[model samples]
Target: MKEVRLPTIPEIVIILGAFLALVFSFTLFLDLPIQLALFISWFFVIILGVRLGHSYQDLQKSIMDGITNGLEAVLILVSVGALIGTWIAGGVVPTLIYYGLEFIHPSIFLLATLIICSIMSIATGTSWGTVGTAGIAMIAIGEGLGMPLPLVAGAVLSGAYFGDKLSPLSDSTVLASSLSKVDILRHVRAMMVLSIPAFVITAILFTLTGFVYGGRNIDTEKVEFFKTSLQQYFDIGILMLIPAVIVVVLLALKKPSMPVIVIGALLGAIWASVFQGIDFADAINIAYKGFAIDTGVAFMDGILNRGGIVGMLDTLVVIIFGLGFGGLLEKLGVLKVIIATFEKKLTSAGNVTLSTLIVAFLGNVLGCAMYVSLILTPKIMEDSYDRLRLDRRILSRNTEVGGTLTSGMVPWSDNGIYMAGILGISTFSYLPFMWLSFVALGLALIYGYTGKFIWYVDENSPSDETEYKGEKVANDY
Candidate 1:
């Protein structure tokens, strides 16, 4: 076995800079596809790995490792694609949109969208699922209500991630807790210190923003057009929501997402067959190729014509290529070298927490895999936290604040691309309205600097109580 060579800071910078430049040049200025940019980046990283004295086979293994790590996410994306297609065909989504337009007042539409998505995400413990299902319907409803699509997308994303961050059933939450060696409940409690305040602020903002559309009289013509177009095609009723309810209930029971989503897709197909009058074969085909509509209403067609396994192909390519690039960086020790530079700056509690956040943010941006950031940042910073006599729960919370919260804002990230694709809004367009994440970042820094929620660990006493600043504090973990 050839010994792997570790990259120096300067070498890592060159590699990262080149990759970023290529990505920006291709996707931004050149109007080229992101997948092609990522593919080229992957090749560039492999070459750099070889230059660092690693064998081609070793680089290949690293790329495969990165790709394998994200296969579950890829599968979820595929399932979501199928679910969207079938749900649209089954009349579930159209029904939701129709009802949303009828009952949800334009003044409170954005706020309603936020709350509805938050509840759905909390129940299912999957933000992607929430976005793919309820988020789609909300987007259409926003359009019919004459609301800005980007604003609605932002509200939905904020609510989805807020629920996802707090829910114990969430994969990112579980992973962060487990990686930090903190009990899940303890981790959740720790997270609330930052999450709650941010969520409250976000809700308030959404509520205020809702009035901008609410004050204006809703375009009854647009609403009637969408409703009439939808009713003309298929049966839109409350019962169509059965498949969605079942999926939510099953997922809430802690069933694995993959099989549950598949079942949801199947149920949608069944609903389409029995309720919407679509043939079983055609429904399945819709799941594979997506639903098609020629309602003569261009806006309606744009909203309804989406989904299918095929729709996920571009996203899959980006993920695969991004992961491969990230994997090569990981295996070549590039990330470790870069992160070590940040570690040296953790001289105090505030700095420690802040540095952890920075590392996690960098991981999300550079690694492209959300899970990688959640895992790697904490793993690398664990010893630092221990050395600082800080509780691991703090470490976990900051890691999530930096990773999961920020993942959807980065254009090339797994969460970012998935969300942009599903919600039909550009990441940049909705990014400013991702209020929870932005607020949480500021709150975390304040908490760290003010020592408000920073808990200290005493190795001398393993008990759940410690004396700090002349007061006995409960360890809480």
Candidate 2:
């Protein structure tokens, strides 16, 4: 057996600098596929690891561990692709679009998209569910209303993530609270200090943006074409919404997301065969290959022609490579080395808070999952907070800021890939419109610097008394 050695500071810099340069230049500036960039980065990091005396077998194990950790997210992405395909074939998505195009005014469409997605996410406690269902419908509605797809994508992501960070049912939220040993409800309360203001400001920005689009001359012809085309293709009606309703209800009841999504897909397949008159063979084909139709309306065709299991392949590539790269970095002791460096510099409450936030963000960037960040941040930073007498809930809130909020913006991340794949817009294109994230991140920094909302441990209280005063029950929306 061989012992692994940690890289020195300069060595860590060389590794991280090369990886970040490769990722950003290729994906952001060069406009190449993220998978390619991640692959190259992976190779570069492995070489550095070998040069530092680690064995190839050990490095391989690290990559595997990273990928293994994220397999559930990978599964969810695959399931979502199938769900979207089947739901579209079954008329569930079209019905939502039809109703949305009919009732949601252009003046409030962007604002409404944010608010509706926020509410749905809160209820379901899952951002992916809200995005895959309502997010899809809103993008189409925005297109019909002649709004820019990227702008709409921004609103959809903002709203989806807002609920995801705050909702008790949200996996990231629960993970953050449990990791800190803070009660989930108390964590939620502490988070509201940062999240609510960001939510309100984002909603306001969307409202103003919506009004700008509202005052423009609408292409009534295009809206009519979409509505008519949908009516011509599928049985658009109230009952078509049943599968979507079931998803929200079941998830709200605390059902696991993967099975609930698969159930939705199955119901959609049944509805496609029964109501839409799609044959059994065609339904199966749609589930795998996605729904397709020649609506003759180019815009309509673009929006409707998506979904299926295969549709997620491109996203899966990025996830696999990204996770592998992240895992390799961990194996090479990049995270540990970096944390040790930061620990020496922790001089004040503000510095500790800021460093914790940076580490949390790096966890998502390097680890490829908020779950990884949520787990790693607290396990590493809890002592730092305690050293300063800062409440651990403050640490939990920062995790949501750096980990959960920023996850959607990284091109190779699961949320980022899923959003781009589902909305048919590039992550970079909508990155500017993720107002809530930008604002929340900014507010977190300010609070850290100014010491606002930074709670302290009550010295007079028992050391074991950390849980909030209330009945310990499962958190709801």
Candidate 3:
């Protein structure tokens, strides 16, 4: 038997640099499709692993394990497609948009979207769910109201991410907290520090921007035409909203997002049949193949002509390739080596927090999943924090913010792919508008470097060091 060796820093850099070069060349200069580019990159990484000492069998296992861990997200994503299909067909989404377009004055549209999405995300604890459902409807309404697609998307994402980070029900929050051995409640409280200011600042920015665009001329007749058309196709009534409500209730009760979303999709199908009089065969088709809405109104048609399990197929393919590559990288032990290097190099106790945040951001960017980064960040940094007498909760908070908040910003990342697919917009289009991401990252960096709100170890009891609390916790948000 041969003893395995870890990758050196130079080898790690070479592997990562090659991967990045491939990504930029394929996605940027060559203008190749992302799915194919990912496949090529994965091949390169796999070959690199073999060039080292690992066998094909080991790499295969890593790829399979990566796929396995991500299966839950895959299923939820597919169900989200089905949910969108049925919700639209059942008149749920259109109904929401119908009211939203009419009542949400353009002046408050962006702010309202941010607030609504934030509430939904916090309740569901799943940003994907919030995006597929409320986020989708919000975009349609924004378009109908003549707002820019990217701007609306940015608002939705800001609120969705904020709520996702703050929500105790959020899977990422739980994973981050549990990985750091911090209480989820404690983590949520800590996040409030940065969360409050970020949200407040983001809200302020949205408001200032709103005062300019909110009063724009609205197309009431066009919007009303959309509502009337929606009524003609499906039963757009209070009853159609029941499925959406059920999912919210179930999620608030802390039921796992998987079954809750499945139920929501199935209920949408049933509602389409029971209330809208859709045929059983057509109902099944809507969930699987999605509906093709052709209302003579081009804009409304464009909004409606999306969703179905089939629509999510492309996004799912991207996830498989991304995670497959991430899995291989994790198996290479490159991240482990890099973390050890960071620990050895950092001299200032304060720099520990900054390094943890930086590594956490890189984890989500490179690892392809927030769960992957959240888990890895703590394992790599917990020892470093303990040695510096930093409270572990601080580490947990930074992990959530850096990892969860940044995932949506990376174009090739899982969160990025899912949001782009569901909203029918490019990830780059909305990246700049993700105010929460910018604000949270900025505040975290400031707090870390300034030693503001950073709690330290009490020499007497290292284990019980949270006695001193930092006033800020946007970390969880």
Candidate 4:
């Protein structure tokens, strides 16, 4: 097979034009609100997509394909929005917040936040869900306890990403495994070598920080106020468990995501009406406009009073634009050019591993989405790994470490932007405490260079497994 070449001048112009349009849309933030900014960004993306190819018809076709590829993700986000809205209305989120306050002490709140989010994200296979729900509450608790906002945001992000890296249900994880033809469970288990260490070190840092900042008195009044308001608005019963249970059961049964999420949204609406004294019209409104709270406690309100379809629209728009940007790059063959450049330089196991890390990082930085990073990196690096006789597990782990871990560190990236916004901290503020991501990257590089944890197939004594399972083209060089 011949090497894929870089895009010509015209292709570069199209790519640059799309990027500039994205920047222009973001500039709307200076004048308009966040929601409006999102709308503008997506509109720019659509226009850019239409102009990227040969003719208007071709551009329209590309736009349609981009939308089709993103359709499932869009539905999932909408469902997630409804789930959050109803969960708030049904008092599930509030109950979690109320109970979380009771159990978590200020001294170890950071570490506790990490653990709780990690568990929840792993269970749901969604870092975003974990962050939007428990993560927001934890940030509130941290503020009430007098912890620095940046540190708290960092802790929440660290835990949430850990789950995202390993969860079989995660879209990025599934993409990486599927693209490489590796077993999902096997890929997850193999990732623990790097992921576990990063998590442990992160926990230790958070624990030590807790001890350093111990004995600060939290505002119990705020906690009480949230609990009261939640009780006032909703029945607050175990029946709230129905929607959550349905999501879990359906996911466990390996059902397609769209139906499962839609059902979950319906259940959320049903529960909101049954328990929250919400009329059908009001419930529908909340599902779209989101529930509002003026708990009078600033931090608690920031945590508790967020949900609805409208609230999720910003994220949805970002996802669509990012995916569309990636699609255009793919169609123009820019990614293939970038990959070929790396293939020429990667000769040893160490180089292959390092290149994989760099590719994953660059993908996230340029592509601005974890799913895009995961999809492109492995495809680019597969040939390099084969030349070094490396196992696919190594590529899988590298992609997770770089793609999943570093995503929250990039300010313009979805996770980082959301975390910074929710925690009321600047992206730069929490960057230092994103210890897990940095540690994971460093560990991957070290292991690759030292061959301490690197796995490879023996070239001299190989049996019948000469061809790598997912290697589409033999590396003739």
What's the CA RMSD for each of the models?
Answer: 3.7, 3.3, 3.7, 5.1
lDDT of 1: 0.84
The local lDDT score (0 to 100) that residue 467 gets in candidate 2 is: 48
Error of 1 at 410 (Å): 1.4
Compared with the true structure, what per-residue lDDT tens digits does model 2 show for residues 1-477? 456678889987887788778878987699887778778888888988887788999889988887786677678777878888899899999999999999999999999999999988988787876788789999999988889889999999999999987788777788788788778878898889899999999999999999998737568898988899899999999999998889888888889878888898889899999999999788978878999988787767777788898988887777787778777877776777787887877867788878888888887777655656776778778778887777777888888888888888877776787788778898889999999999999999899889888777666543312344343322212
lDDT of 3 by residue, 1-477 (tens): 455677788877887887778777887899887778778777777877787788889999998887776676688788788888888877788888877876888888999999999998988888888898899889988887878889999999999999988888887888888778777888788898989899999999998888788757568786777677777776766777888888889998988887888788889888878887888779778989987767787767777777898988877887777677668878887777887776676655457767877888787677666656776788788888887777777888888888888888878777887888778789899998999988988888788878877777566652632422333332332
Clashing pairs in 1: 107-214
Q: Each candidate's lDDT (Cα)?
A: 0.84, 0.83, 0.81, 0.69
Alpha-carbon runs more than 4 Å astray in model 1: 1-4, 461-474
Whose lDDT is higher: candidate 2's or candidate 4's?
A: 2
lDDT of 4 by residue, 217-294 (tens): 566775666567656655766676777777767776667655676576667777778777777677767777777777
- Candidate with the larger TM-score of 1 and 4: 1
Identify the leading candidate in terms of lDDT. Answer: 1
Taking the tens digit of each residue's C-alpha lDDT, what string does model 1 give over 1-477?
656678888888888898889877987899898778778787778887888889999889988988887677788878989998999999999999889988998888888988998998888888987898899999998888878889899999998998888888788888888778777777889998888889889888988989866747568887898888889997999899999999888988889887898899999999999998989999999999998988898877877788899988887887787777767777887756765777777778889878888888887787776877886777778778888888878889999999899999989878888899888789999998888889999999999989989998777645222222223444763
lDDT of 2 at 371: 58
Off by over 4 Å in 2: 1-3, 24-32, 368-372, 459-477
